[model samples]
Structures are given as structure tokens and as C-alpha cells.
Target: MKLATISVGGRPTPAVALGSGRFVDLSREGGLPSTLLGLVRGWDAHRGAVERLVAAGTAEIGPEGVRVLAPIPRPERNIMCVGKNYYDHAHEFHGSGFDSSGGAQAVPEVPVIFTKAPSAVIGPGEPIPAWRDPTGTLDYEVELAVVIGRGGSGISKADAYGHVFGYTILNDATARALQRKHQQWFLGKSIDGFCPMGPAIVTADEIPDVAAMRVSTRVNGELRQDARVADLIFDIPTLIETISALVTLEPGDIIATGTPAGVGLGFDPPKYLKPGDVVTLEITGLGTLENPVGGRPA
Candidate 1:
């Protein structure tokens, strides 16, 4: 089922789409477990509860005019992102001074992970603030984000899918110049309002072929990135197993599967984002996320 979080009467609530622009209210079913983090921690139970609510008509179908929030607002921790997980992406950045060879080598023995602070997250249709730094070179990376269903440590690749509650679209926004200056990715990636996620979270059951989905990004209505998840060098199962071996994967924990080629940084002069640009990211089976760009507040 397609699930979402939306603002009703100025309050955020859980909802499920019922097609034809109708949605079922999940609030009436004991409300949406406080926040998205809570729901993730108790995803199995929550999913069951939501299903029951819909079946019994305890939840009412509402109009489509309501405002929607990120499927999970205020996730429990910073988002975990994989970098250079696609062969082409790795090749593109291999010898660019960021990494040796500009990224044209085989996949790494282990997943290359990074974190984007929770503060960077914004809901669908939200505005992303452009950093005030004159050297800021904002860029976008469209990815398929996996949401952990249950908390676990030492998860095995064979059983990793069991820990996944669902999936959503993620835009791994970055400050390219700052990234190079700091000599690390976190500072450039952790800026507030940089991560745009949501549109909705599709339950794992609804998506049978997570690896085959088509993903793409557009800036100001122009296509910038496009690729299939099947091209991922490490894939989701391996990532979950590898990451869980290092740290406990908790509910609400997001793992961005990495972006495909065609980022601005790949361009000779680079095509960084500027104030007033609109970005739209879409993954087949998942939904579309759109956000506008503006200067950071003083």
C-alpha cells in the first residue's frame, strides 16, 4: 500500500492513498505513533494497525487538497548514504582530485557510507535553502532510499530485506565546493533543508523489484540524471548487511542507495544549483519529490 504523512488542520498525521485522489486517515487509528521515527520503530505493528483501520472503515477517506509532509518527519538519526556505488559515478569522480582515477574502478570491497544530518531533511514540495557561502556549489543526487523496518545489528545479507519496512525517493543535496574545501563530505552534505524526501513510503510488499526501478532527476524541468537501480554496484541487500554489521540499523533509519551518473559535478565547468531553481526527482514505483531553491536565511 502507498502510505504518506500529511498535515491536516495544521497537524501532521499519517495517511494511506485509496486511489482516485482519496486517502484514508491513519490518525483515527490511535494516531500516527508520535513521529515518523516512532512509526519506523514500530513499523510492523503500525502497518498492521493501519491495514485494520482501513479494512474496518475506522479511517475516513479525505480529499486530495490536504498538505503532505515527508513520509517520515524527524527521523531518529542522520540519514546514511552510500557514495560512488555506481560504476559510472565512481569513474566520473575517480581522478577529479576528490578520489583517485575520478571513479573508474571496480566496486569497493565494502560500502562507502556517509551521513547527512537529520536537520538536512525536508518534506516533499519544500524549499531548499542555498548556503550563503559564496563558494557554495550546490548539487543534487537522486537516489532510492531504504527505510529500516526493525532495529537490528549484525544483520546478514540473506536476511536484510526482512529489516526493510519500505522505500522512498531521496535527494542527496550537496555543497560541492564546500565538500572539496573541508576535505570531507558531511559538512557539505549536512546543511539544513538539503535532503528532500517523501511524496510517500511504499511498503516493501508493494515493490517486488526494487532493483529494477528507473530513477531520474530534473532541475528546472530539465533532466539531469537517469539510471536504473539495477546498476547499483553493491545493491540494497548487501548494503544493509554491511552497514548493520557496523552499527545497529534502527527503525526510521534511511539508507540512500547512491545516485547515478549525470550530476553537475561531472560537467567540465559544473552546473551547480542557484537560488530560485526547482528540482524534481522521480523513481518509478516510488513517487516524485519537488522542491524550490532559495538563499539561506541570515
Candidate 2:
């Protein structure tokens, strides 16, 4: 089932997608957690109930009736991110002169991990703070982020899939100059409203073969990035195993599994984002996450 968090009567509420751009307001039902994070933390115990509710649900809101927010609007912590996990993107970034992760190896021997501040997250249709970038070199990285359902340390790659709750699209918006100047990703990638996520989180069960799913990004009307999950150099299992070995991943923790080639930095002159540009990211069943470039929030 596709799970989501949406605005209902001005409140962020847990919901189940009924498709055709409609949702069942799960908030009205008692005994369920109030927030998407709470629901996910108790997912195993609440899964059966949520499933039944969806099965019997009648669509309560249409796409035009309410606003869709990020699946987990405020993740409990910074989002864990993998850098240069795609072969072509690795080569493109390495050659682009923005990569400062050290070494001449375009593709790393292990997952290149970093974290984006939780405050950076914004939901669908929200404006990306392109003006706040300071460096004026805004760029977009469309990624597939895994939502952890079960939390544990030292998880084996073999047991990784079992720990995933669902999937969502994440735009790892970056300030290219800041990224290179800082010599690390966190500062450049963590500007407020830099991360645009959601539309919905399609549960793991709904996605039969994740490797077959494709992810892409379009700036305005031009396609910029396109690749399949199978193109991932580290893959999901390896990422989980690699990160979990050091930090204890918790329920609702998000791991943005890097982006494919075609980022602006890959271009000769670099096609950075302007104030009026629109970025649209889509991943098969996860739906589209589109955001516009604009000045600071009012």
C-alpha cells in the first residue's frame, strides 16, 4: 500500500493512498499513531490494521482537495546519503572538478556516506531556496531514498530488505560551488528547503523488484538524469550494511541512495538552476516530486 502524510484541516495527518490522486484520511481512525513517524515506528504492529483500513477505505480527498507532504515530514535525524553510487555519475562528478571526497578513484571501494540536515527537507510543490545558496550555483540530484522500518546496528546486507519500510523520491539539491569549496557535502547540501521529497511512500511490498525501477529528473521540460536502480554501484543491501556498521539506524531513518549522471555540474558550462526553474523527479511507482526555484521563504 502507498502510505503518505498530507494536510487535513491544516494539520499534517497520516494517510493511505487510494490512487487516482486521492487518499483515505487515516487520522480519523482511532488507535493509530498521530504522525507518520510514529506509525512507521510501530509499523509491524500496525501494518495489518493499516492494510485493512485501506482495503475498506473510500477515498476522502481528491488531489485538488488537499496538499501532499513528505512521507515523513520531519525525520528524527539528518538523512544519511550515499555519494557517487552510480557509475556514470561517479565518472561525471570526478571529471567535473567538484568532487573533493579525495582520491582519484571515480567510483569508491565502499559506499561514500554523508548526511543532509533534517531541516533541509521540504514537501512536494514547496519552493527550493535557490537564492539562499549564496554561491548561486544551484543543482539538482534526483535520488531514491529508503525509509527504514526496523532499526538495528551491524545489519547484514542479506537482511537489509527486511528492514525497509517503504520508498520515496528525494531531490538532493546542492550548491555546486559550496560543495567544492567546503571540501565536504554536508554544508553545500544542507541548506534549508534543499531537499524536496514525497508525493507518497509506496510500501516495500508494493514494489516487487526495486532493481527494475527507473528514476529520472527533468529541469523545466528537458530530461537531465535517467537511470535504473540496477545502475547503483553500491546497491541497497550494501548501503545498509555499510552504514549500519557504524551508526544504529532507527525507524524512519532515510538513506538517499545517490543519483545518476546528468547533474548540472556534468555539463561543460554547467546548467545551474535559476529562480524560475522547475525540477521534477519521478521514480516508477513512487510518484512525482516537483519543486520550483524561488527566493527565501516568506
Candidate 3:
């Protein structure tokens, strides 16, 4: 089932998509969880509620007066992001020289990990505000975001997929100049509204096999990045097992599984984002997440 958080009557409501830009307010269902975070925290118990709501065709509403919010509007903590997890992107990032990889362009033996502040995430259709820094040089990384449903540590790669609840599309927007200056990614990547995610989150049942999916991004009307999710050097299960080995993965915790080659910096002279540019990121099972560039003084 496709799930979302939306605004209705000035209140945030957990929802299930009813197709054709419409949604059913799961919040109104007696005993149902009130938010996406709440639902995920008790996903095992509430999965049946969401499925029943969709199957019953109840509380259907159109998008006209509603605002679709990120599935997890405010994450419990920072977003777990895998950096340079794709072979071509690893080389391109190394070649760009802004990479914190010490100019290393080879595929990593383990996943290159980074954390993007949860505050950076904005819902689909929101503007990706430009940074005030000179060289603005903003870029986009289209990724498949994994949302964990159960809490666990020491999870094995064989059991990783079982811990996942669903997936969403995410755009890891960055300030290339800041990336090089800070010598680390947090500041450059955590700028407010830099992570544009969701139209909706498709449950794992809808996508029993994720590796076969395709991930692609477009700037305005032009295609900028494209790759198969199967190409991930450190695939989802490995990523989960790797991260869980250190920190416990909890319900609603998100992990952006890195981008493929063809980010703005992968171009000759680097085709960075400009005000008014619209970027759209799409993954096969998850819907498209599109955001327009916002005007910011250079």
C-alpha cells in the first residue's frame, strides 16, 4: 500500500493513497495510528489497518485542498546517507575533487557513509532554496530512501530486508563549493530544504524485490542522471547490516542509498543548479519527487 502524511483541516493526517491524486485519511480510522511515524513504530500491528482502509475505500479525498507532506515530516534524527555507493558516482565524485574521499576514485570495500540533517528534508514540490555562499554551485543526487520499520542492532545482511517498512524517493541536494570548503559533508549537504523526498512511500509488499528497480533524475526537462538500482556497489542489505553493526536501526529511521553517476558535478565545467530550475527524481516503485530551485542572493 502507498502511504503518506498530508494536511487536512489544518492538521497532519496519516494517509493511504487512493489513486489519481487522491488519498484516504487513515487518521480518521478509529484506533489507527495518527502519523506515519506512529504507524511505522507499530507497523507490524498497524499494517492490517492501512490495508483494510484501502480495501474498504473509505474517507477518500482529493489533493485540491490538501498538502502532501514527507512520509516522515520530521524524522526522529539525522538521515543515514550512503555516499559514493555507486561505482561510476564514486569515480566521478573523486574526479570532481570535492569528494571527502581523499581523492580516491575506487569502489569502496565498505560503504562510504554520511549523515544529512533531518531538517534538510522537504516534501515533494517544495523549492530547493539556493545557498548564500558564492560559487553557489548547488547539485542534486537522486537516491532511493529506505525507511526502517523495526528497531534492531547487529542485523545480518540476510535479515536486512525484513527490517524495512517501505521506500521513498529522495533528492540529496548539495552545495558543491561548501562541500570542498568544509572538508566534510554535513554542512554542505544539510542546508535547509536540500533533501526533497516523497510523493508517497510504497510499502515493501508492493516492491518485494527492490534491486530490479531503476533510479533516474532530470533537471527541468533534461535528463541528468540515470542508473539501475541493481548497480549499487553496497546494496541495501549490505548497507543495513553495515550501519546496524554500529548504531541501532529504529522505526522511521531513513537511509538514502546514494546516487548513481550523472550528478551536476559530473559534467564538463559542472552543470550546477540555478534559481528556477526544476529537478525531478524518480525510482521505479516510488513516485517522482520534483522540486524547483528557489531564489537566493549570490
Put down candidate 2 lDDT per residue, 90-113, tens digits, no spaces.
Answer: 999999988999999999998999
Residues 6-70 of candidate 3 have per-residue lDDT tens digits of 98878998998767889998876899877889988988887787778777886888878899888
Cα deviation of 50, candidate 2, in Å? 1.7
Q: Candidate 1, which ten residues in sequence have the lowest lDDT sum?
A: 98-107
The TM-score between candidate 3 and the true structure equals 0.96
**Pairs clashing within candidate 3:** none
lDDT of 1 by residue, 1-298 (tens): 8888888888887788676657787777665585656666776667778778788876666665588788877776889999888888877766455552124454565678889998888898788888644576888899999999877999998899999988999999988777788777898888888889988888899999887899999999999899999999998999999899889987778999999888888888888889889999999988788999887665
Superposition error at 174 for model 3 (Å): 0.5
CA lDDT of each prediction against the hidden true structure: 0.83, 0.92, 0.88
Identify the candidate with maximal TM-score: 2
Residue 11 shift from truth in candidate 2, angstroms = 0.8
Regarding TM-score, does 2 or 3 come out ahead?
2
Assess candidate 1 and give its TM-score to the true structure: 0.91
Error of 2 at 76 (Å): 0.6
- Each prediction's TM-score versus the true structure: 0.91, 0.97, 0.96
